[model samples]
Target: MGRKKKKFILGIDLGGTKILMGLFDRKFGLKKTVKLEMDGNRGEKFFFNKLIDGIEEVLEETGSDLSDLVTIGIGCPGIIDIYTGTVKVSSNVSFFKNYPLAEKLKAKLRVPVFIENDANAALFGEQQFGAARGHGEVVGVFLGTGIGGALIINGHLYRGVSGGAGEIGQTFLSIPSVSDFETTRLKVGALVGRNAIASEAGFLLLRQKCPHLLEEIGYNVKKIRSGALSRAIRAGDTALEDLIRSRSRWLGVALANVVNVLNPELVLLGGGMMEAMGKIILPEVRSGIEACALKPLMKALKVVPSRLKDNAVILGASKMACEILKMTQK
Candidate 1:
């Protein structure tokens, strides 16, 4: 059975520590947007209610109505079973082991709902309207609490056998250990995620006793956000900057492996961390890739920062809904 048409739509981007919601009209033009702080440990029910309330709040703010809303598209982290709209194993969201997120949200609002991996949604948005426009082969590496990735091949998103393709974060790489003769093998996500950097900053403070690290982060590792880290580096924290450069280099090496395998024409480095530290980090990453990737692949590859930044997911999600709406109409 086909669903009835409505005059508006909603898109949400759910991150580890932030929730961004955007309201769109029938034409997919953004009407209003609201951002709320998120804490995964607050439990499922509480967060669920918060989502509902936020949705209602946006409609009220814009003088819109729930009855006019058609579909909702949410982009969340982790493994999403797009076929069934289930979010499975989102490590960032502690409460979501495996949940039918789209079904539950649809039941509450009586609207069609769709869920996609956050990285996938962002890549789609970029491909259609942002950085990767007109690119047939692309790779998106998003650096946040974790490293999320998506791949585009032949102008399409490539979801693997289980709807989880282009996920480079889990790929294992060997890094040099403190002992010259040994190497450590670790997942890209675990090795270069924001938490990894935060931990490094904390360790830097303890070992080097850098006064600026304390002043910037104040002992709590979570406080060492991308902006703070960038500021500290700019303020003459050479050791910390070097550490971040090393991490970025590792990410570059990881990308090199990916490029050698996929030979994508474009590689985009993005997310909140990139937004804050792109100037300092992008070059290091490119240098790393240049150090490792094949000469032929490097010749045609374009490495750029994501133009939409954080807005990519919400916009992409909304665009997804609009596409569905258009399909149904035809």
Candidate 2:
């Protein structure tokens, strides 16, 4: 009898500071993974070259070639045109305006390519195999350096018209007493993002003349990352804990809006921020939702932390590649 040929998929996740490429089997289990730092300031060519190099490294490490892969899928952090595979605009990576990413990759690698918004890809991953498994309607909200969101409806990703529907971070709300003169509106991203946490903590520490947080992190505000903040909270930094709690309340408010509208069965949270502080933030988020969201919607909703963590987007992309390959085969 002839040996059964191996079928695999390649998945890439492009984020603000890093790129992850993985080789996956038919079941979306990772065979090999490669990580690369992304320097968005280095221009598009340099970044694209790094992506190609990472893909090649993973394939070589796994003893697989491009021919062994059915398709390649990329989860990009931007407004993506799924039909054209073009990145319209990326807030973190500014150089990717109207970039035909899939076409470029397909040309270089000679394989079918699929592109999707990174959050959407993560949601798809959860739906296929992670937290949202067995749920038809789901909402995924990832808290990291920035907040990102995605919607799943009736077993399919819901990228609304113009492919930019699930941008929950961009939700706006009025802020009171910014300078004691006038109210101001700000995006939820600015209020709850990791960088925002750092900035707000720094400002509060300096304003209130508290040095405990500075002492904990050796006086380096830049070191106030998600993990660092988690450690500080564990060590009884009341000021920092309060700050995180307030921000988490806002996160809950944002999520409540989503829940009230979509009323999905599940709200899966992922990303570094959630991984570090989900335990502290989730209950507060639930409280905020319960306070604001409609009773019926709130009753049916389940907010849970993602089990896949960092690999969610990559696996989701792999699943998407497999789906696209199936379509092509048909």
Candidate 3:
């Protein structure tokens, strides 16, 4: 008789707007996945309840309740304590403040629970199972509402003393400006959410150039995405090209700083805007890095697009769960 397939762990990627759950085997391959709305209400009560509902649904759908799973891993959009499994602060999801997330989930499910920052989890997931799979040292940069980065060193994640290392997007790029007094001030470039500027700028440019798109998409052009901007750029829209160019310049400079610091074997770019702006932005980013970076290290790294796409975080959470299980057993 063939050996039976083993039971798996559960991985949850809880973002600001969505909750994605997946069942993964020991090897971290996803057996099944389920997505549910975040239902961003007021406080912890509503958020936890919504999470409970989603977990129950996934367990039911897979016919594998919490008792059968080895452990659970969660990725939340905030500052987290990987050692204590606590959520410290959250920008987009406010209810996560000081929440004992791992304890609460453990009590409900009666299983070991691990928590990590969503960005770190996503980076780990991509390195283990997605874009940076083959490399020993890798940096994963996620550009969306904000920039998030994860670094893998010697095939293991390098979580700094505070477990908050690799926040590359927060790296500042100073642009020199001269005032009437001849004193110079530096204007920081694009520190806001990458998606925010892309969507907003893309909408404005589209409104000026492609009013027909507004008519076709019901003028809900505010809902425009980075891919749509790329399509417009390819279609020879001058405004769209210019908008991408501007974002690319800012993003390139910021990433160049990150490259100079980490000097990882590879840099994997993921998130909403990367797909649209990657091709146009990476060359310029490389140029900026070469212009500014240390000569020897500048030629060593390669930046590329993510292979797993949107599924990176979910898979990473699952991989984390598997790792936690290994630790517990030892």
Candidate 4:
């Protein structure tokens, strides 16, 4: 009798500022990982090259080759055409408009490739192995450079027509103005995303003449990331904390609306911003939901942070890849 060969899949989570790749066995155990900075401003060639480099590095580190891989899955921060493996448009990475990423990767590696929106992947990961395990209805909202959302209904991913269903960040809200009868409307992303927090913090620091933060990050708005912002808060930057709380409350309101509409069984929050500042932000989010969401819905809903942390997307991608492989075999 011959020994059974090991099967593995490559799962890649491509974010706005970082690219994470993991090699996983058939049971979804991570065997190796590679992380690289993603420069979205650099254009498609640079991005593609970096992705290829990361994959090769992981394969080399794990003592594996393309022939040993079963399939490749990518979770990208963009609007994906899942049926065709094309990226219709990506707000975070502007160069990927109408890009046939799956076809390109398949042609290069001679392996089946699957691509999905990052938030959706994360949700799947959570449902399969993380916080939302065993839940049939789940909604995942990831707070990063921009907020991303995904929906799982009746144990299946709910990708709407055109694969653009879970765009919670783009949902707008109208608030009545104090000075007039008119109401002001704003996109949820503009009010609660990481960029908004960073912008507000930058303005506060500048106005308060706080040189420490500017000095720490070379006074570059682009460089003011979640870690920097968290450090600032930990250093007793009251203004920054206040700004984050205010924005997080609005995020909660946005999520409250989602909970009301979807009536999901579980709501999972993840991404860099949440991972870094969840302790500070989650309370406000909970409060906002309590204030706005239907009482019965709130009673049944479980709002929790992602247990898988940073690996949620990659694991989800791996699961998707494995499922695709099974389908092909069948």
RMSD of each: 3.6, 3.2, 4.6, 3.3
Clash pairs, candidate 2, are none
Q: Residue-wise lDDT of candidate 3 within 1-330, one digit each (tens)?
A: 965444887888886557888887777767788888775556778888888888888888888777667778888777789878888876667766787889988887788899988888888888777778878888777766566777888888887887777776545455334562222212222433555465555566446775433433544644565666666667666665666566656666666676777777787778766766678766655565566667777678887888877777877877787777788789
The TM-score that candidate 3 achieves is 0.83
Whole-model lDDT for model 3 versus the true structure?
0.71
Per-residue alpha-carbon lDDT of candidate 2 for residues 1-330, written as tens digits (9 for 90 to 100)? 975475888888888778988889877778888999877778888987888889889988988888888789999887999878899988877788998988988999898999999999998998888888999998888887788989988888999888888888887656555653333237788788888898888886677543566667765777778888888778777788888888888888888888888888888889888899988888888887888899988778888999888899999988887787788789
Structural similarity to truth (TM-score) of each candidate:
0.92, 0.90, 0.83, 0.93
The lDDT per prediction is 0.86, 0.84, 0.71, 0.86
Query: Quick one: best TM-score, which candidate?
Result: 4
**Which digits, one per residue and each the tens of the lDDT, describe model 4 over residues 238-267?**
777788888888888888998999999888
* Candidate 2 or 1, higher TM-score: 1
- The TM-score obtained by model 2 is 0.90
Q: Give a tens-digit lDDT track for model 1, residues 124-176.
A: 98998899999999999999988999999999988788778878888877755
| RMSD from true fold, candidate 3 | 4.6
